[model samples]
Target: MLSKVVRTIARPFDERFNLTNRLHESLLDKPVPDHARRYYFCFGGIAFFLFLTQAITGVLLTMYYVPSQDQAYSSVFYISNYVNYGWLLRSIHNWGAQLMVVFVMLHMLRVYITASYKHPREFNWVVGMLLLMTTMAFTLTGYLLPWDQKAYWGSTVTISLVEKVPFFGKSMANIIMGGDKLGQATLTRFFSAHIMVLPAGLVLFMAAHFWMVRKQGISGPL
Candidate 1:
């Protein structure tokens, strides 16, 4: 009876997607080299996991967060002090952003140190760098949502640096600021970027990164 139930659950997926054979070829039949068994080699996977965690937690946070000059700090305080387990979620989101960036950097360093970007893997290397930059942007955009002293000052300094760019500096600063200055417009733009544009970019690049890795095969030992 149990065997029959298992077969019934598997049949539709088998017919529609060739799930069994694909799984066999992609997982069981694929050889993962022994060199990849090391702890140092797993940072990319860790960063990807944290990115998923950020998506989930960020969605939950938007329920209580308000992106505005007058209310942003208040909302964050309310979440931290009043909502149940909101503090934990906020902490996870904060440290998760930092850790994700760290892991991606470590992963990139490992690849470069091992010369894993040779030949066919060079494109994946480029995609990986984009992913790292995307992670950094996520951190930067999310930093100002709290509207705290630290967030405000940090964002100001960063945007000020943007204004130092040669020909396009003022234009880029205005676009990011969403106005002549950093206020409600800036908060709204950052919020939109943190939740929408950056995640979409991450998804597309991540898909390419995985596909390239599979196609080129994982880098062998140095």
Candidate 2:
């Protein structure tokens, strides 16, 4: 009786979309390398999982976060102290960001050590490099959202380094800060990039990376 009900519900969609076969082909039938069963080779997947963790927790954080000079710190404080399980969520997000970076670096290292970025996989290597940069941007932007003294000064100090990049350095720094100095506009810009721009870029790069992997069939054992 239950099987009949499921079949009845699935039949139309199956006829229209062939969802069952597609899922079996894409998911169940996909071949994973034997090395991928090991922990070290699994760093990329771990980092990807952490990215999802950050996305979920970040969206929740955004619900109460204020992107303004005046209210940012207060909003974070409220979330930490007042909201139910907000502290736990924030903690997980924070740790997840840190671990994501660590795992991404480790993944890159494993790829490099295994020489998996050769020849046909070189473009995918470039994509992975971009992913690493995007991950760093995520961390840097989220750093200032708390609006604490440490976050403010850390961001200021870090952005200052961009001013050393030759002719366009100062200009780039101004654009990032949204002015000659950091203020409400800076916070808003960072928040926008954190929640929107970076995520979009990450998704695009990941899709391309996965496509290439599917096409190229992951590097052989070595």
Candidate 3:
């Protein structure tokens, strides 16, 4: 019975599996192409590596972070000044985030220029766009967590900009701020969005993105 079931499942897969054989045949039966030596083929892998670094560092930083307006700045300061190598970890998390954003952008540009968005890759392109937006949202929401003058005014500017978006702009700003202005309420909201909502969304999108990549396989060099 088990053998019958195994054969049932394996038969369709065997019938459809041509690409692997074709790839092996091409590689072993013919000469390799020259342009394949370029470094650009590795950009996606590098972007993924940066994202893993960000996740690890972000998790560590969360251990010491306090989300309240009064304590947020002080907790970050303590991490920077008191904890051993905490500053280095936090700095890497911060700058690593910036670099991840840059790399993801470059990866997307590479995909677009190579026309990897065509056909079976269109959904992957959409997922990449969502990931990009989530990265920016993470940065914006995180900016408020430090609660310094820079963080305060930066968030204030962001909220003000949101309030200019059109019909529901003011309401959207209020929803994000959790009230009329930036305060404890706003801080709490941003913290929740940063640590919870955005992360959740990113994870969902990332799963879809990666699954699509595996299914469709890497785009060939143009």
The C-alpha RMSD in Å for every predicted model, in order, reads: 2.8, 2.6, 8.5
lDDT values of the candidates?
A: 0.92, 0.93, 0.84
Model 3, TM vs. native: 0.81
TM-score of each: 0.91, 0.92, 0.81
Evaluation by TM-score, superior candidate among 2 and 3: 2
Q: Which number leads on TM-score?
A: 2
**lDDT at 165 for candidate 3?**
95
Q: Show pairs that collide, candidate 2.
A: none
After superposition, candidate 1 runs with Cα above 4 Å error? 1-21
Better of 1 and 2 by lDDT: 2
On residues 74-162, what C-alpha lDDT tens digit does candidate 3 reach at each position? 99999999989999998998898788788888888888888889997888888888999998998999888889999999889988999
lDDT by residue (1-222, candidate 1, tens digit) is 998999899999899999989989887898678998899889888989999999999999999998888999999999999999999999999999989988999999999998998887888988988998888889899999999989999999999999999999999999999998889999999999999999999999999998888788788887
- The ten-residue window of minimal lDDT in model 3 covers 27-36
Please give the lDDT score at residue 181 for candidate 1.
86
TM-score of model 1 vs. true structure: 0.91
Clashes of each: 0, 0, 0
